[model samples]
Target: MRFPWVDYVVSGEADLLIGPLCWDILNRGRDIPPADLPFGVFGPAHREAGYPAASTRDLVPRAVIENMGDLPLPDFSDYFAELNASLYADRIHAGLPMEFSRGCWWGERSHCTFCGLNGGSMTYRQKPARQAAEEMIEMSARYGSSRIEAVDNILATDYLKKALPRLTALPEKLAIFFEVKANLKRHEVEKLAAAGVRWIQPGIESLDTRVLKLMRKGTSSAHNVQLLKWCRQNGVRVSWSLLWGFPGESDAWYAEMAPLLPLLHHLQPGPAVRLRYQRYSPYHYTAEKHGLKLRPAVSYRYVYPLSERDLADQVYYFEDSEDDDVGGHFAAGSANRRPGLSAVAKGIDAWLKAWYEPKLSMLSMRDSGDEIIVEDTRAIAVEREHRVRGLAREILLAADEGSPETRLREQLSGTNVMQAEIEAAIADMIARKLIVRLDARLVGLALWHPYTPIPPMTAFPGGYFDRRAAPLGTSRE
Candidate 1:
């Protein structure tokens, strides 16, 4: 019953260490010596009998359990049974959390400068498509649920082409949630929706192109916008965040983008937050080289009440302060140096406020007879009722939940529909914001809203994961 962040400060004297941080160390100890191997301690042990802290950068060989099918299926029946009868009943069934993959493929290349989720395990591996489909089906049947929450660091590319088709063939639809990169095409998004992936957490950290580049997110502002557009088109709910405070970023970018915020009103809005430094992130390991001055967050000082050295050993997060004198970092400037940042923040707040409004969204459509009527109320508006017919109407309905141009054309086969008509419909739809085109694919610009009303939760607020009241310093044999 020890908290890793707090207990690790004193638990260094313990006889054994476990969990992911020490997983490779224990497995490879017999095969490779610690010094010559890619895994193990980078410094001296904390105490006379204790093991040194595990290295997060080690590229040691992972155990055979890399294939998720070999693992035991988790049981959530007991928890669900209690939850159903309790006051905390009103909640979204986002489904049971599971993993189909391990580590991040991108991290092995240019890792997002602020992320450390993969830690030492940068090698990517996934359960086979058939195995993954079978596991989800089994879990749904066992738990009487039709949803799965995949906890993969990032959705493996193979899953898009392989696993999706297998899942689509399942007898029942399972609402699967995923974390995806922002550079996906419209067809890929439609495939995910067709395969029962109802939601995604696309890591679109910033919309400012320069800030994105500074963070090495390997994506552009336009690319992020397209992803959001496609997600809405595919009836996929996207949960993302807007982050700022990069070491080498300039405030000018935010200023330039603020006025354009209204144009994005048709899409989902994410909260704007300051960036946080985490353990094993590029920012944490190479702060000095990036012109960043790192220190523990102020809250940690007040919460832990421990010496800085002990806090440093256990803490996995940091606060960055740029030196004014540093050349790459921002220097003291006119008071208006951050006007653009504030403007952008204000725009985001307004966008979020509009997002929750009862009658508004990026786009909402209704199929009416032979003509498709569109209400474009995004940043730029078409106040009049925009309409289209024939091939355009057919394409809109087919792509209401997103479809590739090729898929749409294939669906129109045997009909008198021609390629020129399809292409013209796509062009008109894009101009009216009735649909979004990405990577030569098109998705209808409509957000999916659930029709059923959800039950209210009880007044009491609690969850099983509330570890704040758990007693510490307990030992287990």
Candidate 2:
């Protein structure tokens, strides 16, 4: 029995049984058998009769890289570049996700008590600005990926300033997205906007100063507000992170910060102001330094240490306090409470679809696919439908199709099938590798001569050829 790589084990396939090895068992020096693997080690476990055995021991190694010296940083950039090249090599791949840097800038100074970085130690590095920009350009050329998502913990303002010139030189058609500290200067915001940076995720953990201090966040509430205002003024979309409970927080603090909701609404409403609660996790150094202790973790609905004003505010806002004591509530309503793993995943999915994918596809169209008109139209349709559906299905479907054409077609067909029942009949034909383009030529008129093919249907034995020949139907055309 071989152990599966971490990715394969967590990928959620039934036949994909993952087991531990003798080395792993010996490393932990435990008498426990590898067969006793814990269910829900990666995530949730079903409470059914038969649960798969998973190791209860910690299997992952925790190490922080301060400096590689002679050893070079693994060129994950090249790996990702190749990955995107393969993905977008045909039908203009929109919303391609990329990260220019990793971890947080504050990691160099004071680690956020909640973050897990540098193997739970604080760390930071400045990726070469030119290298990062060139990578984006290469990705665009190779995969026609116009949208770039820089999944850094927080892209330091100074780094952005240095990277701005390089980013400004990128194709105007390309859109960039990244996270930043909420204390960006006015000039920094302007420079980012000028550089085609469209989406900004700011860590505005809380409006309460005490909470910010507790989290070891250096930025002030005033600074967060100023940055948001500046970003909004420059037409930059701000996606902010709001955290709620810290150890010393009480009902009064929550009430005091409640007014920040309207301010956030005024700054950037709807999905733009993403609020999330982060339960404090005490790592070795921070725990020892602050003498912090972990509260017994509870389920999503567990409400502990309740208060009257907190309950009243919950009722007044028509929001149900999450059963667990995690903080941050979206301004839209308390009904949007997300206190569990599933909700966090859904939120991330929504963000990628809405802000990241289309732009990436637009940038990477050249390397991924032929410049055929049919494929172009198909890509455009897929992108448009993705915007309407909020990009959730596209991200999910992208996980399935390996070929560029298949992925693009699957996305379009899946989106169309969701929007209209009429498209259901043709969806299977589009999914199976049977048909590739639709013939839309009349006797002499060839307005639709180069129509992309739809998948073949078993219901129509003649390979669904006649169905494609019928009078042109109403399309997104």
Candidate 3:
């Protein structure tokens, strides 16, 4: 309902069939008669003659599954057996699906403005770390596959403390994937790789801090960048996408953020897309609060003959009526939005295309104690290697987690680096796009050299901060 439902555009005559009117149906120990179930039937069932009348208001709320461990292992033997018997000769290496957690921890605190998922029950719950790890091993052994995928909305951070470490000690390696919040630190990414988590779907919807704020993403752009950088360095495949079109977002935000995309070619890039409104999301339920008027999307008309009012309850997709503009420029593709969006789109397309190219441009650095060497072969500043050994080098590395000039100065207290020198170095790095000045703080742009065990700097040929540096901001020819 969050993504694929928004993108589904095909048309055909069909009844929208919703499965069982049960949220915790699995919790029931025995099969209940249809008469005992809530009679909130839709489509054909309600249309049948002599339909039994039942009031949904009379039914009590189903209890949420308190102990996730109470659930038995999902039966996937049938799926594998069917696959083996099918005409297809090749055996599919299936990633056994499992869930040790329910709801979203982040959502319970601050639901993303555009997220409509887990609306029915947003309370976060998870199995004990040991229980979760045991299931992973048992499922793999039972299903005869080392690949596993967690269907949980977010990876339980508790696993990093114990479960992942336990898996890391196993004799046989297992490939695992999960959706994680992108505010992960370097060691966490390393731990994930060590535990055989080869893939991750991180929630990094936008690169601009202001844009991310509109959706309450609870992560800074620098944090997201660090996650992407750390994942790439640790051999973890990241799955993410960039979204735009928030109601109060400024086109200038995109314009300002687009230039940094090329600086990130070494890292994976996800799709750049427009924001969509979905049922249960804040935008849909409380439209006027965000300066929007909701209506069923035009595509819905193709499926149902009912009026918009009748479709309101059944439909999940929606469109906003606060168009032609809002608060100056807020239309889907407003005039002010195009130039910035075009710039971002072009950059994203190039970033994605580079993965297919034989020689992709990258900005990487290796630490050599106090000295740092940077290799820049990005869309811009591809002239040479950067060598930094003094105050500039100190400032560049100190800002890795994003720090204000005052903090950089404070962190380097009693050092040879002065406040003036720190300011100059940060300005120079921002100009070179070697580091970004985001939200009044400096974040080091170069990823740590993959082969380096500790902090190191890298420079290709023309250094940005060193004395023998070429002119800064040299665009690659």
Candidate 4:
């Protein structure tokens, strides 16, 4: 009842209303018959059975389409027309937003604690693989845009194995982007890059496995690192964020992980921000269970001069009592702000700055047939090259996607390399910052050589987009 004066608040089923309810309201007066309304179209104002519509939460969602293959391609003629008429016309390389699926497959099984995505019902659905690929290519050609970013929560698993293969053979070079899971194998990453997937957002919130576990992001720090390594090695760019303020996380985890950030200067670094309470997130649905006391976010009090009950019912963002106001919220602020978090935040800032320098930091591990060459230029004066031989090289290669010490030992056992030598090699690599270990998992951080020459795949290439975003005209306004 935020606006009790209004008669109806249409929540969902825009499709159903197109020919019926909309026509009724447009042609006739504001007399919409309840009998003709579709499911999720009407609800009681107070969760009961009556007239005035209820909030989106209290109402049932409209029927979802089983197969989204029949869904028509989005018409961007109006958007482009308006953009062309503006001062910034023809300058903006508009990335066409496409979709292959609805709801996250991972979320259907295990939802991320802080993410309120896919609504309450996390039912995974996707179009036929061949159909999806055809639609993407059609859209790209139709819109005259090479970059097509998928709007799906998490990319459909089938799309990678089936759909992406089709794109690899396409005549035009498409720069596609998708939101993927972090536990991507080396081969999977290779497939993505080969299929012209130029960018990805893997949703890597924290590097520490403990912190990751706390967020229910079934991924380890090593897994995250390997993804970065492979992405950098290929021409693919990675977009991720560092989030803190989970219930059971420790500052100690960041302390262990922060000092090692300099070792990863060659890789991309995401902004570190604290978690915010979203409407349907686990933290919001079960606040007391997670030891969080939520209030209707401090700013909402000023925005809407309503009672606590009304405020709670209205606002989507809620803040925990334990949270600090200075660097709170999901902005590009707050480098975690705590003890170890301070170091991590600073490291990320440093990493971001390093990318813009005249001579960028280089840390690449190239594997020749017989030996491996590891060159380190991350340190100012410690520009050195090390030739890896025998078991050490094998260990590094084996730890491509990051592996447990025991698993690596077992995998290399047939090589007749002693356990002592393997341990020493791993420890030495860790000490030298060639590979990092978090909770016994080791992920080697280094770049690989791509087939073609491309600019360094650094995160947020300072002023690159800004320069590109400049108007394509002589007049400067």
Candidate 5:
């Protein structure tokens, strides 16, 4: 029951507290020892130029809490307020940002060949669905904004099912964003569309099945394609996370993946596809346990030699051919370029600013001036969208009523939505936090029921009853 962070906030022992602000406020002014409060700084400068008060050396202790500096510092209240104000300003100019969870779940199972998280040793368990929704609501309130980007490694399927009802009950204006595993089931997709989930980013690490298997991904390329198709059918917008440069991966694998370009085109395109290079980091415990060969941490001075294939592959994506050189591994065109280091640095800076200091972009539908147009040319289109939304709402509402049959029926009925239209609607709803789809079940439902008073919407917002009511007297024969 006793929360240490709350104690620190209450006892006037902390100046700046990060992580979940609600927990800090809830336990404020408790009797506890003053502790070091961790803060996440933004700006390309912070990551590139580095913080003057702290270096990478000082980062670990501040983050760990126990190792906080004992020296007197600035007034806690003013410092925190300024920091928050700065973050708020950033959001206003950048984009609404939200972090659902951190670290990878699979870290506990098998360390991916190219993991960077303390060799994948430090894994953080996911917050419960209810707790996550509460935090999301609080964050939305703080920003006076409904849009959120969930910067989680992967949004777990069960969490989606459990949290859907609570999320659906939130004020019907908040929109949520998050990423998830690609192999979600059909019913889960329907549930998500109903709940009001808006933006979905799936980690499609590779298109090569062999490469996927080597990465220990528990999904197949076929599953990835299917998930994309489902998103298109149900209305989910996808921002794909791709990885390149896995060891032993051949040019043939890249060639095999080339065919997937058209598939990417079929999915809704927002930001240009983010392609990342695989950086190998050996975690002490995890690598040893997995029988992975541990590489000694290299100093900044050491440079690895790249083969002809590496050079050729790197050039394929590099926009400027002129940048290719022997020392070009850390070249300007490399996707791995650090923030504030090159032209790509601008993109990173923009991302951090948009993420931390939320900015509304055209890509975000809430900021659009035009009313959303629903063109139901086909009989199935209208019926499918309405049915899916209705069933999703039933399942969501059933959570409160505690009717198992209603929940099951709601799920079974919703899955009947036409594949293409359902995918499109689900994509749109997922981006808005109206619903969340995971593994073919209505895992989590946001409170965007079609009924009036929006029924005390809970999780996030952006629910509207403007949708054309119930397929206008049955479809034309």
Candidate 6:
């Protein structure tokens, strides 16, 4: 009987005990009998002799490598040498996945209901900023690959002030991937671009505030849209999923959000998917509490012909008893139940089709000294020229990317643009689709160039972090 490797111990087939648990038991000299070895560990264990047992959770913490310079370089040259050179066509260099952190910082607080990505642990730990940056440079140099994917669940906010400056100083601009919160500031997005982080998986799960609150994502719909706009302006490509499915959600929420989708045609679009029940998520843990009765998904029956009890131990996906759990019977790719849910799904589909067909649209603005000339070419029929001077020009220029109403007032500190004029201008622009008022912040939708191309959309696209290497002006080949 083994101790911690309880699967082997449970089968009553192992002759020796190993792993941390066994070592802890032997080291402590505990009085656990051999017959009752696998009590706490998962699954049923059979009894046998000649094996040891332990029940200690004394694992060492992850070490912070202060100077990664001292560590041995990972050897991948031999591995890369075996690959065909033809496979490397049209690429700057091969890519590699790397990690600088573990668990998730946000999961420690309000864990998203449908997320199981963090497993049992939510203790956020990260490498020191300088060590992390240097290691990235070293690894990329050693492997001769410029693409580095940081598989952290969420980027540590401290990295912006700490690691990003050091990363910007690297001679070769390496392509870096990160998972970020959607409520990033405009300056933060700019810094991310400067630091060579060109790709991100910001969790913009839903564009409806009610759905967001139900999932406990701690971000609003406006905030997610703001991120998409900033990502476009700062040249960062966002890879995200739009998921719908939550207990106690109304159909009205989706219907209201659908009409606003066309206004964001210039931004990147992602596929709409149903909320799935995962094993380690809050939804799975408290399914019954939330009026959800779960059975192992249909695929599990084919994989395991055993009893339901046995299958429950192996399967991760589950089918809830309530068919109308999300948006009143929205299932898989089809949404036939409620009109509102169907409208929402259809809106997302249209957005993706527009993006795929390259139905490019933009409202461009230029500061020609005396006045700001605006050209509107959005999907809306009014694709014409408009000129703004004086206070309107000041406000639009100040809020070229985005600004809070309070900050707009602060920026116009010296100008005589009265509060009434600014308010009227903002309202007019929003009505004209030249600018969008998201919550308390106003963002100008116009780009510097007309027909600004939406970056190639992919569920997962690969590229280097250097801005020059981005698929900005080029088509997906």
Top of the candidates by lDDT: 4
- lDDT string for model 6 (1-477, tens) is 223344332221121223554664666444445444443332222343333334211121222233323444356676667643544333334566766776678888888899877655456777777777888888887877777788778998888998899889887788788999887887898899888887898989988777898998988777788788778776788888888767888888888878778877777777878888887788888988878887777677776667786666556787786664533335555555667878887888888777666455555778888787887656662547888888778767766656787888766754776777777887776777777665567767666653323334321224333335454335451
Candidate closer to the true structure by lDDT (higher is better), 2 or 6 = 6
Question: Candidate 5 on 1-477: residue-level lDDT in tens?
Answer: 112222222211133344354464456533222332234322222333343343332232223222212212222354335645773433221224554455567645655545544321235445667666676667666655566667667785566768777777665744666667766775676566566664566766655567777667777665665565456556565566555434345555555544333223323333323322222232222444434342222221143245444432222122212223222233445534332223323332343344322221111111112232222222112121222344334343332222344345555557685555444544554443323333333222221222111111122223222133332213211
Q: Once model 1 is optimally superposed onto the true structure by TM-score, how far is the C-alpha of residue 196 displaced, in angstroms?
A: 1.2
lDDT per residue for candidate 2 within 1-477, as digits (tens), equals 112222122222121123343344456533333244333323211222233543311233222333322222223456556645774333322444655454566756776656543332334554567666666677666655466667667675555757678768655545777777776776787787777776777777665566777778887655555555456556577655555534454545555544333223224432322222222223322444543432333332256344443332222111113334233333334433423322433443353453333332210111112221211222223332111122322322332222244445465666554534324423432342112221110000011222222211211111112333433222111
Position 297, candidate 5: lDDT? 22
Better of 1 and 2 by lDDT: 1
Over 1-477, each residue of candidate 3 has an lDDT whose tens digit, in order, gives 212223111121111211343332445523434444442332222233323433222131323555676677888878879977865414234567788888899998999999877655567888889998988999889877777878889998899997998899999878787889888888898898888786888999988989889999999887888787777777677778898778898778888988888888877789887677787788887789999887777778887778788777667777776554322223346534477877888888888888547665667788888888988887677456888777777777877767776677777766755667666777777776778777767778777776322111111111123233434224231
TM-score of 3: 0.80
**What C-alpha lDDT do the candidate models reach, one value each?**
0.66, 0.43, 0.71, 0.73, 0.43, 0.69
Q: Give the winner by TM-score.
A: 4
160-262 in candidate 4: lDDT tens per residue?
8899889998876677888898888878988988888878889888888889988889988877877777777776777788997788777788888887778
Query: Model 1 has how many clashing residue pairs?
Result: 2
Task: Point out where model 5 deviates above 4 Å.
Answer: 1-96, 118-121, 171-173, 269-477
Worst 10 residues of 5 by lDDT: 359-368
The residue pairs that clash in candidate 1, if any, are 262-379, 266-362
Error of 2 at 429 (Å): 64
* Models ranked on lDDT: 4, 3, 6, 1, 2, 5
Write down the worst ten-residue block by lDDT for model 2: 438-447
Give the C-alpha lDDT of model 5: 0.43
Error of 4 at 459 (Å): 13
